[model samples]
Target chain A: MPVEDLYPSRNRTEPAILDRQDPIIHSTDFSAAPISEEQLRQYEEKGFLLLPEVFSRAEVSRFLNELNQMQQDQALLDSEVSITEPDSGALRSVFQIHHHNDLFSQVASDPRVADIARFILDDDLYIHQSRLNFKPGFNGREFYWHSDFETWHVEDGMPRMRALSASILLTDNSDFNGSLMVMPGSHRKYVSCAGETPDDYYRHSLQQQTVGTPDNHSLSYLHKQYGLESTAAPAGSVLLFDCNLMHGSNGNITPMPRSNLFFVYNAASNRCVAPFCNQPPRPEFLATRETFDILPQRSASQDRKAG
Target chain B: MPVEDLYPSRNRTEPAILDRQDPIIHSTDFSAAPISEEQLRQYEEKGFLLLPEVFSRAEVSRFLNELNQMQQDQALLDSEVSITEPDSGALRSVFQIHHHNDLFSQVASDPRVADIARFILDDDLYIHQSRLNFKPGFNGREFYWHSDFETWHVEDGMPRMRALSASILLTDNSDFNGSLMVMPGSHRKYVSCAGETPDDYYRHSLQQQTVGTPDNHSLSYLHKQYGLESTAAPAGSVLLFDCNLMHGSNGNITPMPRSNLFFVYNAASNRCVAPFCNQPPRPEFLATRETFDILPQRSASQDRKAG
Candidate 1:
């Protein structure tokens, strides 16, 4: 079926934005038509699941165009954008534009996306950050195999809260174009590249000896041993995966640009500390009514009737 | 006394080479003479201990000169180097120069420095990655309060194995000069950050968050509540602290640059993964006869005569 047919008409409008007068429900009701339990289990076991046709081709194209334009503008302002080495591939400036765009904000707060997060996390959720990974065909380098959680855990200690990640493909995805490769259930076995010793860890050639890089081979071997699946979903598809899942992708070998929008959300009750950029939530973004009201509503009538 | 007069002239003869056969043992014995049981306990409770005159003035100056020269050369080749806006007070570059120099390798295996690591870690140790942090007068930004172990645990999720860190100051450290400020024993309590969520942990922005910026009043309040101590040690001093300790530094408000070398070490038995950069130990630096001779002789001597 055409991807467009799967999406409800744009006129359908997202469930009307809730207001302050409407009672706020902090609890999540997973009983509603949400991601299936089977899917959730698969994610837990394999570390990742595919939600195909999450974005229509048109939407993906729109995002890609917007990203390209932003990159062009940033290149003019900062030479950092143009300083790509053949070894590192493209050194695109991240965190520069998407934070301000509406499309990004919409995807970040999309209820459908949030529903999947709620299902996996089994709780209310908050959008932690949005990322626009721009992999231009000309400068794309092969990303080594590793886990996102490995990187995150490197910055903070192991956290118990269940976490889920959703990657929205803003352009057509294929093996030729650096589609993400994930090792199923690798998240359950959390291992550092090297052992707890600094000597065991791999240090980047340029980094000081005490620091080590994530173990790429360990990840690849695990994926091979476990028979992990790689989702080469088309554009507009979203891949929801366990945060600890071992995954990475090679550079886009195709002749076209590969862009994707990544939205990360954590359980509402989970302690939220900002990750990479030091900036806190802009006061305006926090003030949005959508931020306050998008949580699952459990009215007395609905609760009693359902019960 | 002039800085040069503070050390014996013969100190320069060794040039801080690592013994290959028992690199771990040789490295940890050089400074072991001065480390007392009381000092070890103090380090455990306070999170960090300063070692004054660990390096001679000549050694420190030599390292600083090398770093400054490397930065200048890198700036010409890669345009990533930049001066801060409004005031060109701080020069910033994220260049990785480990492959080009042997300084880091020497520091990583320095016997005097490793001896202290072994004493605190209570086992054979290996070098992790190292970095040169040079904060020119009034140029560096204030560091946030956080723990290295907290960050690393998120990445490795492995059992703790004598993880420790050392900071060697090559310049005079004072309150006005960007000396380290640490909260003793805060490493015992781990706090969660936004990036800890498994989902979207790899998103670029997730990495950008700081532990607690200087402007964060809450951090100050917590530091006060935690009985944090700001350290001011002289040049050639070394501070060895637990990886989990909460620490950070203020900007170098003084007129001169504050240069320091950070060496992270873990127990030798620990398995390390390779870093993103493919640089591993060159066969020549791996093991040496000196290490083999010293370790066995020392172990035998101790067996024959208990202290």
Candidate 2:
């Protein structure tokens, strides 16, 4: 059935009631009532915002250390990563840490981050999923330039007021370090690039490259038309962008490894796609009060238990 | 970070591989070498089979009739049904019907409904996510049930392949009419039926009840026990069962409308988590030469019309 008929007819012109109001941005201290009008306008115009010092150095270090340990354990198990054999233009990378990690739980529940999400989403936020993006020093992969929302729409749908992604830099990022580059205001256009015939750059590399390979012409065109901007931030900075914004990062070029924690959040009511397994609740969906009670809390005694 | 690190270590064992000597099951004719010894063992033990079927009249009509005229016209817009709302569970209810439609590309491509998937899965077949279960009747709302999955430990982690669901009736299933009922497996085992608990009975009024509701005791108990089942069927049937095998259905007590087009398949891969949005391709990832050509065909058609 055509997608439209599945939904009841209503004022298509008026924005969906589900779309919350603009956030009330706070001061630079990352403390205020909500995202202020200024912040919301800037985000709408620029497509992304960098919130400063969202994670403490200690927290970042602890998570990284945990990840390093996890990797060692995995290697002992003789696990190996593989790319798609026939190639579906998808990217693949693995991180030592799993989504169920305690640090991940903290990251998901961090009020500072949640506040930003509330601002971006303009509604009570729920985490959709969390992942650690690890690029080893020599990994040549580059994330393709595209909007998260576009990718999400292929699975979710459009004009979502409740969805956004926060990328927390675990290491200092710069042009040399493969900091994310985004086409500002391009998110407003909400273009979907999947399944489209790749222009010259993509076609030539079809046999070797995966989905995230950069399309310079497309990026440049968007930049020229929309005044795109790239984000360079300190290790603790967190960047928030509408799921629909067009963004991606270059391959890691720095000598040090580049790692970032990505937390995806959506409005409380957003239905989640059933994961690959049976109808397990979405990770964020599983965070209901009842489920939360069962989760291991980050108590002071956790360290002793770990030891 | 290898995928193995995501789960705890278990005793080393050989990978569970499908028997190579088993005969190949094709989608056409639903004909295959008789169920192999291994396959029958798996099915009898697991309670499901993967058999493909060529589309027939009853299947197509049952699905098409459920859609409103508007939806029918929309189907013509793109030969495939498009589900835009991934978050809302409702979309699945609306779109899954396409899986049952004989004219639908996916069904047409592979007719033997559960046989091949069963062969690959090496387990009794259960409908994992039949695309056809999504169609809605004029009033909306349909089947309800309680089901759970069995658990197994694979190299990747603790994989739960327990419960499955089937969409047997294709006709409009309205709330006023009785829908499927599930006792929530083993509700009787619970000592106290508290407030806001789901009931073991099937009642349309209870459809929207939440977890703690008095009527939710059955659901809560089943959830606690991790077993629920639905055994509703019609001519062309689709049924899903948990690997652990604990679930049941309320009879089709209502008279609003009902039809059936069933699909049963098993998880091709053992991982129970949500699939990676961008998992690297694996050698076993199946893609026919026809896969790439399908898109180009559409592009060609669009080009011709524009010219």
Evaluated with TM-score, which candidate comes out highest?
A: 1
Q: TM-score of chain B, per candidate? A: 0.66, 0.26
Candidate 2 CAPRI-style tier:
incorrect
Q: Write the per-residue lDDT of candidate 1 for residues B61-170, one digit (tens) a residue.
A: 88778767766774433542222222453443222232235776566556666666666666676554455666764235444455564334333332342567788887
lDDT of 2 by residue, A178-210 (tens): 567676766655342323323332223322443
> What clash count goes with each model?
54, 80
Just chain B of model 2: what TM-score?
0.26
Model 2 Cα lDDT, one tens digit per residue, B111-207: 2433334433444432333344333322233222222221122211224332233444454332222233333323222222122212331122223
Which residue ranges in model 1 land beyond 4 Å of their true spot?
A1-30, A75-93, A96-98, A156-158, A195-213, A272-307, B1-307
Candidate 2's C-alpha runs over 4 A off are A1-32, A35-37, A75-99, A156-161, A194-220, A273-307, B1-307
What lDDT is reached at residue A306 by model 1? 8
Provide the TM-score for each candidate, comma-separated. 0.38, 0.37
Interface quality of candidate 1 as DockQ: 0.01
